[model samples]
Target: MNGENAYLATLMELFGRANFETRRPRTPEAFRLDPIRRLLEGWGNPHRRYAVVHIAGTKGKGSTAAMAEAILRAAGYRTGLYTSPHLHTMRERIRIGGELISPSTVVELFGRLRPAIEADPDLTVFDILTAMGFLAFAEAGVEIAVVEVGLGGRLDSTNVVSPAVCLITALSMDHTEILGPTLAHIAFEKAGILKPGVPAVTAPQTEEAMAVLRQVATERGVPLWTLEGWRYGPEEVAPSGQRGKIQAPDGASWSIRLPLLGRHQWENAALAVAAAIRLREQGWIIPDEAVREGLERVRWPGRFEILREEPPLVLDGAHNDASAARLAETAAEVFPGRRWGVIFGVSADKDPMAILAPLRPLVERIWLTRSRHPRAADPQRLAEAAQALGLPGRIRSEVAYALEEALAEDIPVLVTGSLFVVAEAREAWAAWGRMPMPEVDPIPVRVGGR
Candidate 1:
C-alpha cells in the first residue's frame, strides 16, 4: 500500500478501537462551551499558542479555510489547516502545508490523548479530533492555523481559538437540529466565533442572517466586512477551470487569478482576499503578490472537481440548498448548453428536494444512488423526490452502479450532492486506475474571500 493509504488504515483502526463516536453520539443536550474548554485545558491549551483564523458557516467553511491557508502559506507563513468530513482518510482533517500529519505523529498524539479520552469517555468525536488538531498544529510550530468549525460555531470544538479574524461564509439551512431551524438562528450560531474587537469577513447572506451577524459583531465591538460590497469581475476563465479576477472593495481594487472554478468560487476567493487584507492591516505582511499567488495555488477538492475527462466526469459535494444552488450556477457556466448525466446521493437529514430542484433543468438523466454512509438517502426515496419535481431519472442501489448507468449514457456525468458520494466515487476511480474517454481536466478555481 502507498504511504497515505497505509497511514489511513492505521488511523481508522485506532478510531474504531477508541469507540470514537459511540460514547458521544445521541448524547443529552449540552451546547455549553465548558466541556471543550476543560478538554483543551487538560492538553495545556495548545490552541492558544498559535494565531488562528476561525471559519464558520453552513457551507464553504472548509474551502474558505483552505483558501486562507494557501494564501498564508504563499506569504511564507507556516500554516496549519483543520477541516472535517474527510474525503478518503481521517488524516485529511489535520494537515500542515497540504500534507497529512504523519502516522508516527498520529500515534504519538493518540498515545498522549488516550488518558484524557478514557477519563471522560463522554467527549464527542469532533471534540477529540479538535484536540488532536490543536496538539498537532502546536507541535509543528504552525505560525498560523485556519480552523473550520465541525458543526455550529457556538458549540463546535474548534471554537477555542480567539481568532485573528472570524470568517463566516454564506449561511444557509444545514445542521438545523443542532444549529436551530431558522436561517437567522443558524447565522447567530455561526457568528458565535466573533471575539471582542476581532474583525469579521462575511459572504453574502440573507437580510435576517446578515442582521444577526452585524448585531453580534456590534455587541462584540468587532468590524464586519460583507462580501457584497467587495465585487470582483471575471477577467478570464481557463478551460482547466481557473478564473482570473479583479476585486473592488471600498473603491480599492486588487487583481487575483483564482485556481478554482465557478462564479461562486470567485466570491469565495474574494472573501479570502478580503480576510488576507484585514490580516495585513493588522500588521501581518501579506503582500499583493501573495494574495494573487496564494489564490492561484489554492487547492480545494470536491467543489466542482472534475475527476476524469472522456465522457467528462465531475464531482461536487453540494449537499445543502445554498451549495446546490451554487453548483447549479457553476454547471450552467462551465457546461453551457450541455445536458449532463447526474449521479447523485445525499444524507437523509438534508432537504434532497432543494438539491434536486436546482439541477433538474440542467440534467439530461439523473441516476440516483446510495452513498456508503448509513445516513445516505435510499435511492428509491431519492428517485421519488426527483419524480416529485417532475424530473425524469433512473434509480440504482449503489454508487458504482449509478456511475455505470451514467457513463453508459455517453454524456458528461456529474456525481454530486453528498461528499460521501464524491469520496466513494474518488475511491472507485482511483482503484480502477483507468482513465475514462473524453477526459475532462480539473480546472481549479479560487473559492472564498477576505
Candidate 2:
C-alpha cells in the first residue's frame, strides 16, 4: 500500500477502538460529558478558548450549523465548524475557515490524547474527536466555533461548550431508544444544551416539544426565541437553488437565496438568521450583508444533492420520517411527476418503513440495499419492509449495485435513507466516471463518517 493509504488506515484503526456510531450503546449512561471534560481539562480547556454557537435537534442541525459557520466566516472571523456523521471523510467533522482538518493534524491531536483516551474505558470515538476538534481549533487560533451536537444534547460530548447562542432546528422522533419514545422526551434532551443566560433560538415545533423547551429555558433563566414573529415569504425553487424573504420580529425583512433545496431549508435558514441576529446582539461585528453572503456560499453535500442530469440522480441523507417527508415534498416540487426509482438503506436502529412511506407515492420502484457501515440495516430486512409498504423492488447486497439498477430505469433516481448510503452511491457514480469525488478533501479518505 502507498504511504497515504497506510496513514489513513492507521487513523481508522485508532478510531475503530470505541466507535459508538458503528456499535450503538443500549443504555443512556453510555453518553456523558465527564470523560470528555476531563480530557479537555487536561488539554488546557481548548474548547473554552473560542466563542461557540451550539446547535441541537432531530433534523436540520447540520445544515443550520453549516449556515451559521458560513455566516461567521463571511464576517471575516477565523471560524471553526464541528459537525457529526460526515458523508465521506472523518476530517469533514472538523474544519477551520471552511477547510477540512488535515490528516497530520488529526494524527498529532490523537497522539496527544492517546494516553488519556486509553485510560478511560468509558471514552467513545466521539469524545476523542471532540477533544481533537477543540484542540485543533484553539491551535489554529479560531475566534469562533459552530458545534453541532452529535446526539442528544444533555449528555453529548459536544454539549460541554457554553455557547454564545443556542439554536434548535426542527424536532421529531429519532434516536428514540436512547433519547426517549415521545417528542417531549426528545425535546427535554435537546433542551439540555441551554446554558443559563444564553440566548436560545428554535424553529416552529409541535406544542409538545415547545412546552418542554420553554419549561427548561424558563427553569434555567435563559431567553428563548421562537419563529412566532418570524415569517418566510414565498420562495422560488429551482434545481440550482431557492430564494425567499424573511421578516424578522422587529419589522425588518430581507430577501435571501439558499443554494440548498426544500422548504425545510427555509426554516433552517430562518433559524440561522435568528442565530446571527442573536450574535449581533452580543456585540459581534456581523453585518446583514455577511448573513446574506454566508448563507449563499454554504455548501452541504449529500442533502438533496443532484449528482447527475439526463436521468437525474439525487442524493439526500433523510434518515427520519420528518426528513423523509421533506425529501419527498422537495422531489415532487422540483422534479414533479418524473419517474423516480429510489435506492434506500438505513441504520439498523431506524424504522425503514417510516422513512420509505413518504416516498411511496412518488417512487415508481425501490432498490433495497445496504451500505458498508457496520450499523447499516440488512438488505433483506429493508426489502421486506419495502414489500410490506407495497413498494416493489429486489434487494442489492451493496449500494453500488442498487445505484446501477436504479439508474437503468432512465428516470430520476434518488439515493436516500442514511448518509452512508448516499456516500457509497456518490462514490460509486464517481468511480464509474473514472474520477474521484471526495466530500471535503482529496488527500485522505475513508468509508464511514459516523
Candidate 3:
C-alpha cells in the first residue's frame, strides 16, 4: 500500500479495539482526565505550548471555532482548528491554516503516539484523536489553536487545555442524556471550561442559563461578557449565503457576507467577532478588515449548507428540538409560502417527535429514513413516532431511495435530523450526481461493546 493507504490501515487496526463515539454514555469513571493528562505529560504537553480558544455550547460552537480560526489566520497567525465527528474524513476534524493534515503526517505522528496509546489502559478513540490534534498543532508551530468541545465540557477529552479565552454559544437542549436535562444543569457543565481569571464570552442565553454561567464565572473570578450587548444589521438571506453587518459591543461593526445562511448564523458571527476583538485587546493585532475577510472565507460544512441550486436544495444537521425549530423558521423565511420535501433521520436516543413536530407545518412531505450509523433510530420506529405526533411521514429504509423519493416531490428539498444523516445524505448525493465527497478511511469493525 501507498503512504495514505498505509496510514488508513493502521488507523483501522487501532480503531478495532476501541469504542465508537456514538455509543451511550459510560460512567463518570470512564471520563476521567488523568489518563489523557498522563498521556499528554508523556508527550511533553503539546497543548501547553500554544494559545487556545476553547468553545463549548449546545449550538454554534463549531461555527464560532471555525470563524475564530479563520480570523486569526487572516491576521497572519498560523492557526489550528479542532472539531469533532467529521462529516466526510477524520482529517477534516483537524486543520492547520485551513488545510487538512496530510496522510504522511498522520502516519508519522501515530508512529510516536501508538506506543503511549498501547501502554495506557484508559485511552479511547476520541482521547487519542484529540491528543493527535494537539501534537499536530504544536508540531506545525501553530500560534493559536481553536478547539471545540467534543461533547459536554467538564469531562470532554479536549478540556485539558488552559485556554486564553473561552466561549459558549446559544445553549439549549442537546446531549441531555449526558449533560443533564435542565437548561441550568447543562449551562453549569459547559461553564466548567471557564478558568480562573480567564476571559469568557457567551451568546444570548435564557435567564436560567445566564444565572448559572454568571454564578460560575463570579466564583471562578473570570471575566464574563455576553453578545446581548452586540448588534447586527438586518440580514439579507439567500440560498447561497447571507449578508449582514456584525457589530461588536465596542460600537465597531463590519458589513460581512457570511457564506453560511440563517439568522442563528448571524448570532454566531457576532460571538466570533466579539472573540476576535477580545483577542485583539490581548495584543493579537487582528484588524477589522481581517474579520470581514475571514467571515467570508470561513466554511463550516453540514450546518445550514446549500448543496444544489434551481429550487434550493439544502442540508442541515439540526437534530434537536431547538435546532429543528430554527431550521423550520429559516426554511419558512427563505422559501416563504412554498412547500418542501424533507429527508429526515435521527439518533435513537433523541425524541423524534419533538424534533419532527415543528417541521410538519413547513414540509409538504417527509421521507423518514435511517442512516448507516449503528445507533440511528429505526425508520419504522420514526414513522410510528411521527404518526403518534400527528406529523405526516413515510418510512424509507434506504437513504438513497429516500432521497430519490423526496426529490421526486419537485419542491425545494431539505435533508436533516442528525449530523450522521446529513453526512450519509451528502455521500448519497455525491454518488447520485457524480460529485465527490472527501475520501475517508473507516474501519469495518463491530461498533459497540467490542
Full-model lDDT, candidate 3: 0.83
Lowest lDDT 10-mer window, candidate 2?
441-450
Give the candidate number with the greatest lDDT.
Answer: 2
For each of the candidates, give the backbone clash count: 27, 0, 0
TM-score of 1: 0.90
TM-score for all models, in order of appearance: 0.90, 0.96, 0.96
Tens digit of per-residue lDDT, candidate 1, span 1-450? 765465454455445432322222343255455666777899789998988999998777888888899889989999999997777656678999777886667667876887777777556556777888899999889989999987778777788798999899888887776678899889888988999989889988889999999998899899888876666756676547655665565686667666677887777777888889889888899888888888878888788887765667888999887788888887777667768888988877777888888888788888888776656778888888888988767888878778877777789999998887887777667656754422211211111110
Report lDDT (Cα) of residue 69, candidate 3. 91
Q: Across residues 1-450, which tens digit of lDDT does each residue of candidate 2 receive?
A: 654665465576566677777777888888878989998999889988999999999999999999999999999999999998877778898999999987777777887788898888778888888889999999999999999999989999999898999999999999988999899999999999999999999999999999999999999999999989888843688888888888898987768888999888888888988998999998999888898899889999889998876578899999989999999999988888786889999989999999999888987888888887778889889888899988768888988998887777687899999998888887888889834767533433233322
User: Per-residue CA lDDT of candidate 3, range 59-152, in tens?
Assistant: 8888889998998899899999998777766778889999999877878887788889889867878788889899999999999999999877
Overall lDDT per candidate, in order of appearance: 0.77, 0.87, 0.83
lDDT of 2 at 14: 68
Q: After superposition, how far is residue 333 of candidate 3 from its true place, in Å?
A: 1.4
User: In lDDT terms, how accurate is model 2?
Assistant: 0.87
